[model samples]
Target: MLSNLIRQGIKPTPLIVCAGGTSSRCAADGLWTVDLRARHRQLIINEEREEVEVGTGLTMAEVLQGLQPRGRSIPVGLSTIPGCGFVLTGGIGPLTRSQGLALDHIVGLCGVWGNGNIFDLSAPTNPASPGTASKNETHQQWKGLLGAAPFLAVVTAIRLRTQKLTPLVIWRSVCSVQQLEIAIEAAETWEHSASLQWAWNDNIELFITCCADDPAAMEAMQSLRTHLGYCPESSMAIVAGQHAQPAFGTMARAADPQERIHSEVISRLGPAWGQRLPSLMADLKELMNNRPHAGCQISAQQLGGASAQIPVSRTSFIHRNAIWKPWINATWMACDAKGQESALAWLMRANNLLSDYCPGVHLAQIHPHLSCHHQELNDAFKNWLPGLKHLKSHLDPYGLLPPL
Candidate 1:
């Protein structure tokens, strides 16, 4: 099909590919739409390699459900609705501190680049595998695909390593910003088996989760929880593979059918930004007061642990030291131009606030809105754009997919 377009000296209109979810995608008007869900919904688990190969169409929910029977799970974002794009980008979840980002599990992929060339690439899982790739070109392509596949190719399938499923002990509370700051400080020093996440609406709702996979980690979780004080509102026990995170479900939800939401995700390396947390929260609280819409939200997920062990050169996710992933999500009623402008302006201001902490942007989703698109890309891909573009020139010279 792609060949026919090239043969006719034609190209798909600038397009959006729906791998499974629409939470972060923009409008489809005047653009070609490629929906992969209907035809690509297969899931297969290979016990020998302890991996599962998923069709790009599957949502994280479906993948987890499938893994449940096998007693295995993969680290993914907060909610399951993100679809495969979640992994193609860096999938940061509460378990990331212990398990690493979703992209880190990708062992192989099958894809077609922008220029209609098909290829299969794999990353070695152990020393016996080819890390010192006998074929240097293939090695480079493998690294490029793990985090930046959406920009460089149409990935049809992915093979991801899975972990033994475990139960998570979670607690929730509504706390003062100062308490939240203190919790953040303690979390930074906590064991990787635990993670802290919070979102602010009318109040600051705090959530801290620890995987009860081992005795030592459980001890650390208790120490941190005690230090953070009491939580009047706690949660029921949850087996990690049995359900999606109930706390940050909003992050994965789209607006009403008649509404639209836009998000600007930002990340900053930690150990350096720790001291400024108190002031940052205060600034954010002030900013939220003037929001044009009540639906806007500010949320953050802690990063570090196993994620920091990988070097920046390994994947397109260059913020190897990032210990905080915070985002400003702005939404408006459908067709409300004035409201849209206000919300976007508010997001820009929020980004500006984050920039002060030596921020690195995550191109979490495409920004078809030209005004912020180019600038955000520059920030997100600093020092890596030229190398990515060189690959694009060879693989997608026709600009068949998204451009940097």
Candidate 2:
């Protein structure tokens, strides 16, 4: 269908493989839209190689379900309902520090470029895969698609390097700002098997998870637990035989099913941002005190470990030095136009608050249809945007996809 549309001099408005984009953005002015959610829904698990080839339509939840019985799972973010679009940009969750971002786990991709061309960039390093990038052109496309696939092509499927499904020990506590700072500082030195994630709303909720069977990781988890003075009996949830999914459900806040949620995941992807994070806590506390509404809040997942070790040039997600992906979310009642305006205004204000602390951004959720899209595009890729634009021109010159 995409090839036919492109061949006929028609761009499909924007190829709709949602990677966490909002409904309003997709339905903007109700332009001629094409949703390929059903086109590629296959999930093939290569047990010997320990990788999962997931089709574009599969939700994170479905992926986890299939991997669960196999004793392997990939790192997926909160609310696992999103399609592969979740990973194309970046997907961060409690397992991030241990397993790395979901995108980092992606080894191969099969997609149709904007110009009606089909390309299958399989993982050469994987013994079960069939291709290697001996040529300069194919090499660049592999890197290009990892972090920018949604904007450059119609991705039909992806191959992910799945991780061992180990026991997870999770602890959550309502922390004061000072305790939160202490936890964040302590997290920086924790082992790769341990991670911390926190969110701020009516109260600041902090959760730490560890693959507790690892003695060293459990030790770090205990140390942080002791420092926070958490009541072990009440705060800990030990899913001793489960992977990430079960543990996360115990800690995740349930959104009211009725209200509309519009949010952006973001960060100043830069060096030593974690070291500077605590310094902003006092001011952030003040901002939370003055937030526009009860629905407006902030959350962040820790990043580093295996993720930071990879070279930035290997993918479009350039800010390898970033240790935390903190973002502000603003939500409102669906029918309240004035509330929507205020909520959005606060998000912009909150973004400006953290912009100077870092030199880059995370297009965590691609928002090519919004006002922040342009600013985020320029900043997210920084110097790399020019090269990405040149690549986009080659693969998607018809403006058939989102802006770079």
Candidate 3:
């Protein structure tokens, strides 16, 4: 298929291979799109090893459902979107604080590059592997494709190491700006069993999840209550269930699928941003006072446990020191041109205001269509770009995929 396109002298949108079709990286003029959803839809589970080989087209929810009965789970995104693009770009999720990014669990990959050459990347000792390359050679290729596969290849399948399934205790609370700031500070120093996700949409809502009922979880909850001034009888409810139950389901229902919404996302990494939350919240409140749409929101996720312990050089993901992932997003109706412009303008201002606090960006929320895309990419990859660019040049000389 790629050879035919190349022979015909055609270059389509770089998003041709995206399984979720969620990125804004595609050409605005609507170039040809290559859909791979129909081709790769299989899931092969290795129960003994707690590993699953999945088609790139599969969503995180689907994978979770498949693994639920087997008492296994993989670190996945908060949304039930396609898993391939998520892992390829350094997947961040609710369990990131404990399990680390999803990319860290990848054991193997199979794909075709722009040159129409098929390659299987893994540890090389597995006999079922198709690549005959030496161990060192395969390892080099593995490092390159770990987080930058979108820029070099069209991945068809991935084998990921899964973890033992465990139930999670979730606590939700609504707090003021000051209370949220206090909670953010508390979450930064939380243990591996606890993680946090909070959102601000006029009101602040925090979701704290713990994998166990240990003393660490109890202390974390106590600290939150003390900081937020909430007592046991003060509407602070703790719900317990499987991690898969509320993690993605709540997010899935947040928006109406039938509505056509135009949105922009800006992600930033701040290692010590929690310390400046009070000032940041003040600035955000002022900027959001005249928001273009009611659906506009800001969210921050704590990320400093196992996710931060990993060295930056181990994978193409470079934001190892970051303790927080904060993003500002705004949405407007498709026909509301004025609303869209206003929302985008406000988002740009908000991003610029918070830029000094954050030094890196997440690829999952990156939009190449934005004017600051180049700068964002530079911030996200930092010193890692040179190696990634070399790999792209060697494997995709024609620039079949979008340049990062």
Candidate 4:
């Protein structure tokens, strides 16, 4: 179908490869949209290998449901609304500190390149497994696709490595700015089994979830509590054998869902950013107070542990050493053009204040309008850009896919 479109000299305004229209990346005025909603919905479980082959059309919720019965789970981002694009771009989730990014767990992928050529990239089923491509070539391609597939192709399916399902204990508490700072500092040295996310919406709240079965995880949770000087007003919940989906869901429910929202996101990566949390929080508070829209906010996610252990050279994801991903966003009703402009201006001001502390940005949260597209490509892939560009030329000579 892609070939037919290209052959007929038809260019889709933006080829959005998602089943649901939940992604903010979708082009509002695209001339054509190739929906992958019903294209690949298969789920094949390889119980022996503890891996699952899933169609790109499947939502994270569906994938989780499939894995639930098998006593396995995959690390995923905060929202269950994503599909292949999540893994294609760097899947940072609540369990990322322990299991690593979803991209890190991928064992194989099948996709249609921009030029409409079918390509299958997979790890050897076994050490003795035979393959046409040389080991070096396969390794290079694997690294490339781990983070750059979105700019190169439309993924049809993916085979991801899964871990045994485990119980999680989640703690939620409202904190003062000073207490939040202390919590952020403690999170920097948290164990792999523990992760933290705190948000400022009217009042500041910290959400900490840990793998209950791990003694070290429990200890780390205690350490965080001690650092924050826990208050009696805090609330906590313990799930026997479940992911942090419920916690994420609760946060989502708190937000008012608008049918149309115009927003700009700026994500910065660096360990120094964590050190400057207090000042960052101050800036966020000011922004929120003067927000042009009601839902405009700033948030951050902790990144480190096993994710930091993965070297940049090992994959196209260049921000492996980045310990925190702090993002600022401004959202207003899409129909309110004037409000959107004001919100965007406010977002830029907030971004400028924090830009100096951030040395890099995450690809998933990139916006072409706020930052230079080419510069973003350089920052994201760094030295890997040349090789990626070369591959892009070979696979997408017409540049049908989104520009990196």
Candidate 5:
């Protein structure tokens, strides 16, 4: 692909081959199987320390399972089925409120750069060498890893910390849109008192998931449920390997059993911009003026426990303090190109609600509405540009790496 694109007068760039995409619905089609070895060293899995040195090609779910026996877990985005390890782009789940972003636990990486030279980046001991290896500094290094792409290197192996497993408290409710707004306001207020995770759709429905090590969390959940005035189906425990139910139950009979059409923008908010988010549904209400493009929704997963403590600069993922990582999505099962395009376009427009609020990284699905700056190879990453370029120059000065 690189040779052909270059022959057609396009620029050749470094490309990191990844395997096992977790977010099939949200990524460029296809996969690349890459080596998982750490240069000439043997891979390590320190279950005693709740950490593992893994191949970048492994799926998020795979990584979780790898640590499951140890009763340890990592914060990951919603879809864990995708094969590659691009969790830093945007990850949210039941464990997010406690554990932080998936990339937060990364402690080390070994990969081939554009120059074809394999390099390892761990936490830095000194501020000057931001690429050094250390336990806590891994998250900072991971943040630098994004956007630089294959220029820095193909991430072959990643070392990340894990956490102990805890119980999950999930609640489901169906309400009118007006009721949903009231529920959202109540949920947001309760977020401080209860530390809850919640989502809602344009159809005026809500789903809230809460987690804690104590019974107080349950009490808080009860308060929110009472305030919302809806009897929720309770005790929906969210554990690893089990499929999660849709935040809002079956939409239409025409909807695919697996295809849950809910809007992330309405229910879940991204890391940095949730508090004062300008609602997309509010805008759509004005634009369509009573017309519904099948409606959009927002859902959320809380990040808590060890996640809240992870530093922003620690990993490529910077959204550590975010209350909830909102997933702004719509579901459709159309296979025709035209249907695909329409669904994609609608999702893009819904996502654009955040364009002015926060910049996002591509993970489960590539953002088609991503601005030209975001699409530019370098803009994909911030702050780590120089190091990546230096690696590229050293590894592929001849520019043999594939272009974006």
Candidate 6:
């Protein structure tokens, strides 16, 4: 791949940095990439609540399913699929309101630096050697590696705090923006807010989805319902009305009533609305009734749960503070240039809206509009820039890792 790029007179891009290719089909056009699993070999969950150590390869779903049996789980995105790319970009999910993005819970990480040196970093205390050294010494050691980005390394593993696995309750429905705005406004104003939330406008291809769990989920839902003020006719008469059918992949799953309606709606992905954005609630209803798109589906997740406690000073993830993260997806019958271009254009618009309030996004999913240079991007991390740069200098002087 490197030789091909050089032969083509193109500069060498980073290796193993592309994500799962869900963000855009064009991502598959790139060469040399790795998923979370290929990068790390093992996953270790401590006997007690000590901590969970994960290889970069594990997806959010894998992490949850692995640890849930042990009464422990880490906050991951709703799209529990695996990839180090999201965490590197910014991990947001149902845990954002509570646990925050996956990156926030990360206490330590192991990865190969640009110079090919492997390094392990964590908060001052070393769990593997708890009794070997004084707390002071361990803390001093951990403090030496904060604010570092993958610019110096390809992350292989991560250690993070964990919590008990609780039953999840999902409430969803398809409605127009008008019906949804009431809920959206309530959710936006809630004391703690949602764990995950997202919306799709007219120009975008997908309808929005949001999720909120934990104790506050019930309360948030109630608040949203109250603000939405659903009436009997209005509720039952939403877009697609009662005749909506579920999309292909979603038909087999057991979902809440709202999800059933949402599944029916978001499947529609044509250029129907023109320039006028659909009312949040109305759009959802239309999606259920219309099944608009021939090749795409749109959705969003409400983030809450364990995601709120963590701050933004950790790794490269920066959406730890948003109310929700939105995703625009396109699935076509074939992978071709035309299909790829259509998906990319729609995704670009959706991502542009998503990045409005949430700036930092997964680099793998980055759209050209969101592109930024080194210095401007560095300033986004504030005081942490100096430390990350220092780590890059020490671990990857050649800057082989992908540029953030």
Which is the leading candidate under TM-score? 1
Regions of candidate 1 where Cα sits further than 4 Å from its true position: 1-12, 124-134, 240-244, 249-272
Clashes of 4: 0
Q: Output the TM-score of candidate 2.
A: 0.89
lDDT for 204 in candidate 3 is 70
Q: Model 2: per-residue lDDT, tens digit, 273-380?
A: 565776678667877887776667787777788788777777888888887777777777777778878888778877888776656788766677568888988888
Global lDDT scores for all candidate models: 0.73, 0.73, 0.73, 0.73, 0.48, 0.46
Reference-based TM-score, model 5: 0.69
Pairs with steric clashes in candidate 3: none
Q: Residue 245 lDDT in model 1? A: 57
Q: On residues 1-404, what C-alpha lDDT tens digit does candidate 3 reach at each position?
A: 64456445545645356566666642256666556567777889998877999888777777778888888888776666555787888887777887888898988898887666788777444434455456555655677787777777888889999988866666766766777777877776776577777877756777777776456776777677776775332333343334344542233134544668888888888787655777887887787677778778888777778888876766778888887788888788899889888888888887888778887887776566778888887887888888778777777777777776
Candidates in order, TM-scores: namely 0.90, 0.89, 0.88, 0.89, 0.69, 0.63
Evaluated at residue 182, the lDDT of candidate 4 is 77
For 88-200, candidate 5 gives per-residue lDDT tens digits of 34455655555555566666667654544455776454434434355334433344564234433456667777666554555655554455555545554443323444444
Per-residue lDDT of model 1, residues 1-404, tens digit only: 64444334434545567886554563356666567787778899999999999999999989999998888989877777778998988888888888899898998898677777777788844422455545655766776787778778878889999998888877666777777787777777776577888877666767767786666666766776677677676453555652655746332223333445444444433333567877887898798788777777777887788888887777888887888887777767777779878888887887788777646777677775547777766676778878888888887787767776
Model 5 residue runs over 4 Å out of place are 1-16, 23-44, 84-90, 125-143, 146-151, 187-205, 232-254, 257-281, 284-312, 319-321, 330-335, 359-364, 367-404
Model 5 worst lDDT window (10 residues): 31-40
Per-residue C-alpha lDDT of model 6 across residues 1-404, encoded as one tens digit per residue: 32233234322455544333344311334545545445464679986655888776666566666776677776555455645555554465554555555556667777655665555766643334446455643343333233234455566677888865544434444444465454555555555534324334332211222232334646666556566565432221111110121121242123312311111111111111222334434544454333333434455555544444444533444334544443445433343556555555554444444344345433324332233345334434546556556656655565555454
Clashes of each: 0, 1, 0, 0, 60, 56
Off by over 4 Å in 6: 1-13, 17-30, 34-39, 125-150, 192-217, 226-299, 302-315, 318-321, 329-339, 342-394
